[model samples]
Every structure is written in structure tokens, then in C-alpha cells.
Target: MLSVNNIAKKLNLKVAAGNKGLEKQIKNIDISRPALEIAGYFSHYSSDRVQILGMTEISFFERMLVDEEREDRSKRLCRKETPCIIVTRDLHAPLELIEACNQNNIPLLLTETNTTNFFSQLSSYLEKELAPETNLHGVLVDVYGIGVMITGESGVGKSETALELVKNGHRLVADDNVEIKEVSNNVLMGSAPELIRNLLEIRGLGIINVMTLFGAGCILEEKRVMLNVNLELWDANKTYDRIGLEHKMVKILNSEVEQRTIPIRPGRSLAGIIEVAAMNYRLQHMGYDAALEFNGRLNNQIQKNGGLNNDF
Candidate 1:
């Protein structure tokens, strides 16, 4: 839960009144523009959001001063579990509104930004702060600007492969436990925990600091996860996708990411395979598919041969 005091500190909001209610918690990220509610239309009023009072709402309150029931309406609106009230454009809250807030212990905040700008900024901040996140056991590395997450069973040499990539000019994002957050609907961001950042745990060598050994360029604070590479032991019975015609995807935090499964065996250079995989993924993003091009050329050759024996 995000507290009103934390939001105030983050947004640089000034406490206009009701300082005692700073500890109020905000459950929802969406804010409210209480124009209709302030005008006595509370049928669909939302009390879970932070009420934003802009120029128009303040003007309405000013007009309400001529009415004999102004204080009653103001108190009715403030006497709910509304998170807080934010007055944009540095507009001073009317005495009635402030009194109502004090009476109900509802926090009132002031901001210098205009209504539209503040709403947009605060909504974005709240969305990010309240984003859904999950942790996965994997090794995340950034190779040629592509974020690749390596996953497999234990003893599959995931860390060793990541170390080799880091030695070859790639950057390590996280090792072992990777915290992934869905910042947007289709984007998943990967990062390491504070205690394990820039640290890699190898089988024989134990824990080693990648940043200290490989410099700052070999480590990244966070990266947008683009690909998932699962390394598994070589199985002769299971045929791998040599043609790369079939597309694979892995779901992470409700986002589907392109995935590749690489079979590991003795004498196989996993680091080289992963590096090429990253580059190939980037090429696919640029609308280049080598497998498709090869298949097309093969079909063209068969057509030219008049359906002759096309065995290659």
C-alpha cells in the first residue's frame, strides 16, 4: 500500500491541511476528478481514489459559497475514506473545504503543476510503483543491447555461460534470482536484488563480483527482458528445431517473450550459441528471418527443376 505521506514526498506536494492523515494508505492508482461529486451528484462517486481539485472544481466551490448549504455539501464529500485531496496549480483550498478536511482528518495537498500535467505525472508514477512483479530463478544478461534470460535446471552451467558472455563484452543484469516487473502491458523489466547485484555464484569458484572483475560496462542495473533461452541436456530422442520455423514463447508476468531452447552437451560452446542467439533475435526484430529466406529459396529451386528429385 502507498501512503499519502510517501506520495507527498515523492511528488513534492505541500501539506495544505490535515497533516495528521498523512499516514492514510492509497489502494488504487487511479485518481478522481470530483467535479460531479462536488456538484451534489454522488451516485457513482469513488472514494478509493485521491481527489484532485483543479481550477474548475475550485471555481465550483467558490460559487457554492452563495448557497446556504455549502458547508453541508463540503462536509458530506470529505466525510468519506477518500485517500486525500490534491489542489493543483498551487490553488489555495477554500476555508470550507479545509475545515471539512480537518474535521474528517482527510489530507489536503498543494502542487504547483497544472491539473493535466500533474494528473499525467502522478498516474504514471503510481502505475509504476504499483506494478505487478515476480521473481524467477535465472541468469539475465544483456548481449549487444538484447536482454536474454537463461533458465534451466540446476547444474546446467547458467552462471558459467553468463560469465563467459560478460567476458566477451556483454553485461550481466542478474544472476540466480531475477526480479521481473510488468511495467506495462507488454513489457517485462528484469533486475537483481540489492544484495546480489553484480554478483555471480559459480559451482567451483563460489561467489564472485562481476562488476569488480569486469568493470562497470559488464554490469547493468536493469534491462527490458526480450528473450528467454532455456538450456537443457542433449537428448537424442528429442529432435530440436533446426529449421527455426516454429516460434516459441514463454509467459513472464503476463507478458509472452520469445524463447529458444538450446541443447547442452560436452564440447558444445554454450556461450557462443547464446551470443549468436542474441544477435539472431535482434535480426528477427529487424524483419530478417534467415530460416524463412532459406525455405523460400529451396522452394524456388524445386519449381525451376520442374518438380524433379529435390532431395538435398
Candidate 2:
């Protein structure tokens, strides 16, 4: 559960009342506009969410003719489960609401951000912070602006290829272990653990800090993994996709990424192959497929010749 105090620190919110309740746990990502609750309706109130008292809600409360009714409604909105109350536009908190929040130990925060923008920002932060996450043993790098996750069995040279890519001006996101979070539907974000950030472990090379060796420009804090390249020792009996017509996908945390299995062999440039894969992925997105073009040309030539020749 994310705490109200953490949210305040992250968003730079100011405390107006109920400082004691800063430790309240925020379970819901949605924010609530307490317009109806302020008008004395609490039947369908979502007390689990953080409350937002914008200009409209504050103005409506001030227009209430009876003080006792206003106080009663304010008290009802400060239920125990309610995460906190945030007043946007730097509006003044009503005395009744402030007193009720203090009595109920519900925090009341204030922010100068517009209500709609703040709602969007807070919802996005909550979604990412509370998203489902998992860790994988791999190396993540940004090749030609595409996030590629290099995965394979132990001692398959994932780090060596990533280091080569880094030397060729690509950015390194993570090495050895990557933490992936499903922030939204079909979007998986990958990052390195805090302890291993910017640190890569290569066999017989010890641990090297990529940022220190290559500067900060070649390091990314996190990236959306767009491709997965799995490496393995070349097997003579295995059939590989030489035509690039097969579509492969790898699933991670409810999301799937374009996957490619590259067979490792001596004298082959893995870095160059992966770079071309990234460029090809961008081309495919832009409605151009080299494999499709080649197949179309082959068909055109065959059709012009009126069929295949038979040998006696």
C-alpha cells in the first residue's frame, strides 16, 4: 500500500490539516471529487480513494446556508478508510472540513496544480507505483531507439553483446538482472535494480560501471521493452527463420514483445545482427517489410516467365 506521506513528498504537496494522518495508506489509484458528498449524499461515496476538493466543491460548500449541515457532511466524508483530502487551486479549506479532518485524523493536503491535471498525474503515478512487477536475468539495451532485451541461458554472452552495443553508441538500461513492470495494458517497462544500476558483470572482467566508463549519455534509467532477442549456441540440426516470415512473440507480465532467437557462432557479429533487427522493426512499423518486398519481386519474375521450366 502506498502511503499518503509518500505521495505528498513525491508531488510536493503542502499540508493544511491532519498532519497525524499522513501515514494513511492509499489503496485506490482513482481520485474522488467530493461534490455529491459535500451536498449531503454519502450513499455511494468511494471513501477508499483520495478526495479532491476543487474550486467547485469548495464554492458549493461555502454556499450552504446552514453551518450545522455543512459540518455534518464534512465529518461524514472523512471516514476512516478515506486516504486523504486534497484541495487543488490552492483554495482555502473550509473550517468545518478542517476541523472534521483533524478530529477524524484524515490528512488534508493542498496543491496549486489544476484539478484535472493533478488527477491525471496522480493516477499515472499510482498505476506505475502499484503495477505488477517481475525480475528476469537478461541484458536490456537501447539499439537505434528500440528497447531490446537480450535473454538466454547462463554463459550465452548476453552481457558481451550488450557491451559491444554500448561501445557502438547504444544506451544500456540494465545488465545481469532486469526488473520489469507492467505499468499498463500491453506495456512492459524494464529497469535495473537499485543495487546493480549501471553495473554490468562480464565473465573474467569483474564488475564494470557502464555509466562511468561510457558517460551518462549511454545509460538509461528505464525503458519500454519493445523486443526480446534470445541467444543460443548454433545447432546444425536446428531450423532457423532465414526468410524473416515467421512472427515470434514472448510474453512477460501480461504483455507480449516481438521476439527473435539468434544462434551464436564464431565469426558472426551479434551486435550488428541485433542492430539490423531493430532497424527492421522500425521499418515494419512504417509499412515497409524487406522480406515481403523480396517475395513480391520473386513472384513477379516467375509470373513473367509463364511458369517453371521442366528438365528432360
Candidate 3:
């Protein structure tokens, strides 16, 4: 984990004689550029995690404070200690701002890059590092409450299958791009991105509204995945499962869900097969073990026939 302590130690190792700035002590950073107003907004809280992004191009930010005496409310909001303040774009710090920051012990970061790019990189890194392990994907749905995600080589009838499924009575969660988030432990929430919400595209049909064509019952905003049916083109020489024995799992967040691969071939109804697969998954979850039962019956028959080995 990258932390303020680590950054501080790195700074200590860098400058042989230079003093550490107030910005060096912050553990969590919030970036707000070209505005000191945010300092007044959340600055009252001593524990607040804030990083002010200052414009180095502006000279008006050099305002000074004659007396550090603060109001009673301000005193209560901010402790004697303050958070770090950062000035961007290699701008020179006015003596007043420097004095104020030094008095408050707020670390100041002065950099040479433009404010926009600096804040952008800071926010981007923090968000990526802190975000949950869910992904943004497109989901294919059907009438049987099956949450099938249509994914394959780009142009492989994924969205087309989903459009047909929706027309037949199933709902559409997200088209083109789906937003997946982990709200609680063990649960993965799936939703559609705003740009392509409730929309699906077919080769010849063009853009179509799932809700408008299929009615309200055919569109869903979000649903937890019960099974993952990977759609692959049918390979003539490739062996496929004739019986459900080996269990496949897809990991989402910290949880593992079941998976299956279905081959898409000419004259085959992929949407129907996907629905059936989902139904089979539900049945298995309800304590049905077809392979185990079949094996038990086979063993019993062998023993009854007096032809089984001693191991049986």
C-alpha cells in the first residue's frame, strides 16, 4: 500500500538538508484546484482528508493573515493542527500564504504542472487504487430471470442475441457497457452505463430501445449473476460436454459463481439454450446432483449383477 508515511520517508531520503512541507504528512488526499474556498468548507475539521489544488498562474492567492485568531466555531471545527495545502504549476508562494501555512503547520506542495492535469492524475490514481474489484461489462438477459453476459470476439452476435431475448420477454440490464459494483459482502451488483442504458444494437436492425419493444417486464436495471454462460463459436473438432460433471466457476469480487461454455452454431437458438442452462443451474443449487445420483445407480447395478470389483 502506498501511504503518506512511505512518501514522507521517501522525501526524507531525497532532500539532504531541505525541511519537509506540511503536505508531507497527509495520509488521505482530496484534490480541489484553483480554489481556497474548499479549505473553508471542510478545513474546519481537523481529521478531514483534503488537498487543495492551487493555480500557480494566479497571484491573488498571496493574501496574508495579520492575526491568526479564529472564531469559536472555526476553533471547534479545526484543531490547532491543519491538513496539507498544495499549490500547482510551479508558481511562487507569496510570503503571506507561506506564513499562514507555516503557522498552521499545513504542508504545502508546489509543483510545475498545470492544475487540470495534476488534479486529474491524482484523482485517477486514488480512484483506481481504492475502487472495488468489480468490472464494467455488457449483460445479456432473457425472460426466465437468467442473467447471461454476452461476451466474445467483438462482432460475435452478443448484442444481437440479447436483443432477441428481450423481444421474446426477457429484460435488458445494460447494453454495450455494464457497470458492476460490490455494495456488500459477497454480493455483486450489476447495472448499465448511462450512455447506453436500455439500448441494444443489432447488425441490420440498428439501435433499438429494449424497454420500448419488450415492455417493462423485459428490462432490468441490475441483477446479481447466478451463472456465467460463455458464448463461443462452434468448433467442429472441439470436444464439448455431453454431461454436466466438471463444475466451472467465475470469480466476481471475493465470491465465486458457476460458469458454463455454450457453443454458438448455425440453426441453433443461443438465447433458448442460455435460458435452459440458467434453469439447470437453479435446479442444481436446489440440491439436485445428477452425476452423483447416476454414479450411485451404476455402482448399485454392478454390485447386484455380481460383476463389480471388490473396490466397488
Candidate 4:
């Protein structure tokens, strides 16, 4: 839960203050409002917040708030509390105006790309992963202290597996959409999606409440993501990992996460496999590679057999 006002400070946006009376609420308020407010960079408390403008839009926005008759420099001076100003194309915003914004500490980001892509990405980041998360749905279970995310399309036994993991004494972090981010090079964290907070969907059962069913142990606010397991329909034809030799990665932002794809089929236990995978991944992270160990033993055997038996 991030307050929108706090976000404004983080983005370093300037608010034009058409009325100027609203400035006090903007300054003193300390509550998270993840929705979008004005356009520019996302200010703290606004939901889906990001500002976008064309030259014409800028002109109108500027003129709308200022007393302009001479030349309408209002366009250049309009934005008051935009977190950042992003200019597209080979454009100039006049020297004096640029200097004024710089003096006020507004970050003016320039990109060669259009406004569409910029807004798209910025919004996506703020919406999905950047915003603060509250864990109410699902559970954050620890498999030997490694955070494991168990999610599948619809049902496919996600929550049911989580129940087993918790019964096995693993802690639950979150269910449904796990908001993950690489905060640091060595760390990736997971939490719940805001809208569907603390809710898990079970096919043929509609939405069954996780927190209500399992109590406090069934809910987790957040956890560092050591690994991700995406459960998909089991494919008999596809070659599954029998040796854990190949490494898997899922890219989130600039960070690369170790990921495993587990096939789901009848008779195979999903939770058990995910638990094992999480343990194995943690071991690998700790420098214990099973494949490497196997290879070493194989090499030793070959050396003892006089180096590969050239004739055979």
C-alpha cells in the first residue's frame, strides 16, 4: 500500500497548482493512493498515474491555468507537479522554461521514442511490480526457507498444493498474481496483486477464500523470490528435466530469475515436485550442483577405464 502523495515526492514532479489552495493536501497527506492523478511522471498516491502530452496538449494545459495573452508561454509553464517531463521527437521546450524546471528539481527525461511506448512501460512498472503489495490471498510458504510461487491457469491444483506445503510446515507468501521485482542483483521479492488481494480461484468452486480457510498461516505479505515455478499442462511428448542439468531463467526488468517449468498431469504430485525443485535450486545457489557432481563421478570412472576405451 503506497500513498499517492508519497509517490509524487519520489518521482520529483512539479504541480502547477491552478487553485494553489489544494497544495496543502498535496503536501501533508501521507496515505497511499495507487491510482493515476495528473500526467507527467506518476506522483505517489494517484492510481494508474502517469502524465502524457503532445505539443498541442501541452499548450492547452499551460494556457488553461495561466493568464496568457502575449504569446501563451503558458504551454511551457503549465505543469506544476509532474514527477518528470518526458519530451518526444527532436523537440525543444525553450531554454528559460527548461532552466526553471531544472531549478525546481523536476526530472526531464528525453527519449527518441513516442509517448505511447513510454507511458505503456512506466504504467506497467508502476502497476504490476513497483507499487507496494499487501498479502491477503494465498500463502507464502517456505521450502527449506526458499520462497516458492505455485500458480497455474485457473485451478489445476494451486491452492490445494499450497495447503499441502503449509501442512508440511512451509510458510505461504501469496497466491494468484505474485508481484515480483528484482530490487537488488542478488534478490527478487514476491507479493500479491492489489485488486485481487488475498483471493484464490478454484475451478468448479468459484473463488474460495484462502485466508479464511487457513487462517494467519495461510497468508503472507511478501518474500524474496529465490525461484519461480510455472505449472503448465503436462506434455507426454515433451522432454522433461531428468537430470536438472540445464539452467532456466525468467527475465523481470533487468534482473534474471531462476525459473522451472513443471508439467501437471494426473497421478504426479505438483506441490511435492515444486518443493523439491525449490530445495534443489537453493542447493544449487549454495554451490551444490547435482549435475556437476554426477559428471565428476562419470569422469573419474572413464579415467579408471583407461580414458574412454578407444576401440569400443
Candidate 5:
């Protein structure tokens, strides 16, 4: 949730009038132009949004013949649910409109930015501030220019794998707890909380600061999560994907990220496997699939030989 004063200060808008209602809450991310509302049509006026009055809207109101009509329109736009009123291009608000805003106790803000540019700016700011967020238990690391999240049961060596990756020149985004926000459709941005930022925990070894142990280059403030790696204990009865053709996914927030489950066992390097997975994911995105290429080669050789040979 954002208040009218919060956005005004963020966008550096000037307070033209209605200073008492700066604390009004802005619930909707969408802004309204109020062009039709200015033309005496309030059938579908979005009162919950921040009303923007550009040159066109101001001109329409000024062109009205009767003063009562203008006052009525201004009064209707400043309903109880309205968050605030903003004038673009530093345009002047009508006298009746200013009086209406003061009467309704709605904030009146002004900006020198043009209509189109201000719309883009305000929309971008609101989208980020009001985006949906969730907390996740995992370690997010940047490997091979990809955001790889390691998740599994406690003590499954997630932190250990992340430490190894950091030693290999990778960047650590978050440790143990990752706060993810859905900035856009199907895009998740993960970052560590303030208290645990740049800190890693290893069982029996206690907690250590990653930035202090390694250089600042090994720490990332935030990263866009692209893949999820789940580490599980090795179970002989369970079957895992041997070939790379099988695709798995996990949902985090509103995005579905590619998932890979690696079985943990002695003498097996988890960090190396995760590095290869990140690299392979990048390759697949670049239109190169190793599994498909190998399958195609095997099929061609079998057809050329005309039959299977078991003379070994």
C-alpha cells in the first residue's frame, strides 16, 4: 500500500492544493486521465485511482460554457474514494477543481513532466511498490550468468554447495531465506533480508559473512531467479531422470522456474553438477540441446548399420 504523500515525495511532485489529504491510501496501481469525467460523463469513473489532468483535460474544462457544469464535474471527480489529483506538464488546476479538492480533502499534486512520460514513470513506480511478494527457504546464487536457487530439506548441503560456488567466482544472492517478488508477469526477483544479507550459515561451523570472507564481488544485492535446484538424499529405490530430455518445473510466486533434482551421495560433487546444469540451461536457451543431438546421432548410426551388433 502507498500513500499520496509517499508517491508525491518519490516523484518530486509539487503540492498545489489539498495538503491535508496527503495520507490518503492509493490502492489501485492504475491511474486515470479523467477525460471523460471532465466531459460530464461519470458512468464508469474510477474513483479509487489517482486522477491525472493533462492539457487536454484542462482545456476541456476551460471550454465549458456554464460555471455550474464545471463545478459539478470537478466535485464528482473528487469523490470520497479518490486517492489524489495530479496535474501534468505543470498545468494549472481549475479554480473550481482546486476548491473541490480542498473540500474533499484529497491531495492535489503537480509535476513538470508531460502526460505520456509521467504516465510511464508513475506506472513503473507503482508496479514495483505494489508487486506481490513471498518468502522462500533456499540459497540463491548466480552461476554462469544464471540465477540458480538450491532448495532441499535442512542439512542437505545447500549452504555448502553455495559456498563452493562462491569460491568458484560465483555471486551469492541470498542464504537460507530468499525474499522473492514478482515484479512482472512470470518474472521473480530474489533478494536477502536486511538482517541476513551477505551472511551464510553452515551447520557445526556457525554463521559466516560471505562478503567478509570473500571480496565484495562474490556478493549480489539481488538477482532474477531463473532456475531451481533441489538436492535430495540418495535413495536406491527412487528413479531419477538420467537423460536431459525430461523437463521439470517448480512454481515460485507467479513464475514457473526450471527445476533439477540432484541426488546427494558421498564422493559426488554437487557444486560441479550445478555449474554444468547452469551452463546446459544457457545452451538450451541458445538453441543447442545436447541430449537431442546425441539421440539424433545414435539414430543415424543405427540406420546406417541396418541392425544391432552384439558381438562384444
Candidate 6:
């Protein structure tokens, strides 16, 4: 649960009144304006969110002063389970509102930012902090600015391949356990946990510090995952995509990413292959597809030859 005090500290909010209720938990990320509630409309009022009092709502309170209803309305608004109230644009809370908040033990926060800007920033922060996340047993690396996650069986040499890529100047984001967070609808950010930020574990070499040995250039704090590389032992019986015309994809957090299956065999430079794959993926984004071009040329040649098999 997120506390009102934590949100205030994160957003650098000033405490105006009711500091006692700063420990109140904010169970919902959605904030409330409460303009209608100030006008005595409580039919669809939601009280389980942070309430924002902007100039408009303050104006409504000012008009209510003539009717001698400001204090009563403010009391009614703060009577519910409202987590906290934020006065934006550096606006001072009305004396009656402050009294109501203090009377009900509802935290009152003040911020210099405008209402719209403050809401946008706060919503984004809450969205990321409350995003869904999962962990995968693999290695995430940044190759040529592309985030690639290497996954396979337990003994598929994921860590070794990541180490090789690090030696070749690629930065490692995470090793062994990659904590992935879905920041947005289609974006997944990969990072290592605090306990294993710069550590890499190889089978024979045990554990080693990639940041200390290869400097800061060989490690990344976090990266946006763009591709997945699955390494498997070479299986001659199964047919692989030799021409690369057909591509595969993997889904993570409801987002699909381009996936490549690399068969590991003796004398094969896995690091070089992975690096080239990253570059090729970037090329595909840049409107250049070698496999598609090759297929188109082959079709053109076959049509020119009247679809006849020319085997000399």
C-alpha cells in the first residue's frame, strides 16, 4: 500500500494541515477533483482517492461562503475515507477546509505545480510504481542499443553467451534473474534486482563482477526489451529457418517481441551471431529486410523462366 506521506515526499509536497493522517494508505491511483462534491453533489462521489482542490474548486468554496455553507460542505467532503487532499498551483487552502481536514484527520498537501501538471506527473509515477512485473531466468543484454533477452534450458550457456557479448562491448542489464516490468501497454523494461545488479554467474567461473572487471561501459541500469534470443542445442533432425524468411515472436506481459532461435554447435561463434542478429533487427526497423528482398528476387527470376525448373 502506498502512503500519503510517501507520495508527498516523492512529489515534494508541502504539508499545509492534518499531518497526523499522512500515514493514510492510498489504495487507488486515480485522483479526484471533488468540484461537484463541493456543490453538494455526492451521488457518484468516490472518496477512496487523493482529492485535488484547484482554483475552480476553491472558487466554488468562495461562493459558498456567502451562503454560510463552506464549512458544512468541506466537513461533508472530508468525512469520507478520503486518503488526502492536495491544493495545487500553490493555492492556500480555505480556513474552513483546513479546519475540516484537521477535524477529520485527513492530510492536506500543497504543491507549487498547477493542477493539470501535478495530476499528470503523479499519475505517471503511480502507474509505474504499481505496474505488473514478473521475473524470468535468463540474461538481458544491450547490444548496439537493442535490448535482447537470452533464454533457454538450464544448461544452454545463457550466462556464457552474455559474458562473451560483454567482452565485445555490449552492456549487460541482468543475469540469471531478470525482473521485467510492463511500464506501458507494449513496453517491457528489464533490470536486475538490487542484490545482483552487477554480478554474473558462469558455470566454471562461479560468480564475477562485470562492472568491476569491464568497467561501467559493460553494464546497464535498465533497458527496454526489444528482442528475445532462444539458444538451443543443434538438432539436425529438425529443420531451421535457413533463409530467414519466416520470423517468430514471443509474448511478454501481453506484448509481442521478435524472437530468434539460434542453434548452438561446435565452432559456432554465438556472440557474433547474436550481435549480428541485433544489428539485423535494427535494420528491419529501418525499412531494410534482406530476407524479403531475396524472396522477391527469387520470385521474379522464377516468373521470368516461365516457372520451369532449370537444373543444368
Q: Point to the candidate with the largest TM-score.
A: 2
RMSD of candidate 1 to true structure, Å: 2.3
Model 2 weakest 10-residue run by lDDT: 303-312
| TM-score of each predicted structure versus truth | 0.90, 0.95, 0.56, 0.54, 0.90, 0.89
lDDT of 5 by residue, 120-151 (tens): 99999988777899999999999999999999
Tens digits of lDDT, candidate 2, 5-30: 99999999999899999998887877
For model 3, how does the per-residue alpha-carbon lDDT over 221-240 read when each residue is reduced to its tens digit? 77765667777899999998
lDDT of each: 0.90, 0.92, 0.60, 0.56, 0.92, 0.90
Task: Mark the regions of model 3 whose C-alpha exceeds 4 Å error after superposition.
Answer: 1-137, 306-312
Q: Select the stronger candidate by TM-score from 2 and 3.
A: 2
Whose TM-score is higher: candidate 1's or candidate 4's? 1
Better of 2 and 5 by TM-score: 2
State candidate 2's TM-score: 0.95
Q: What is the lDDT of residue 17 in candidate 3?
A: 15
Q: Compared with the true structure, what per-residue lDDT tens digits does model 4 show for residues 1-312?
A: 333343345443334322222221222211222112222333343321233444554444354434332123323333455344445443454343455445544443344445556455545445444433332223345677788766456656777777677667676666666666654565667776667555666556677566677677656777777676777898888998877777888666556667787888788887788778887887888989989898788788788996766643
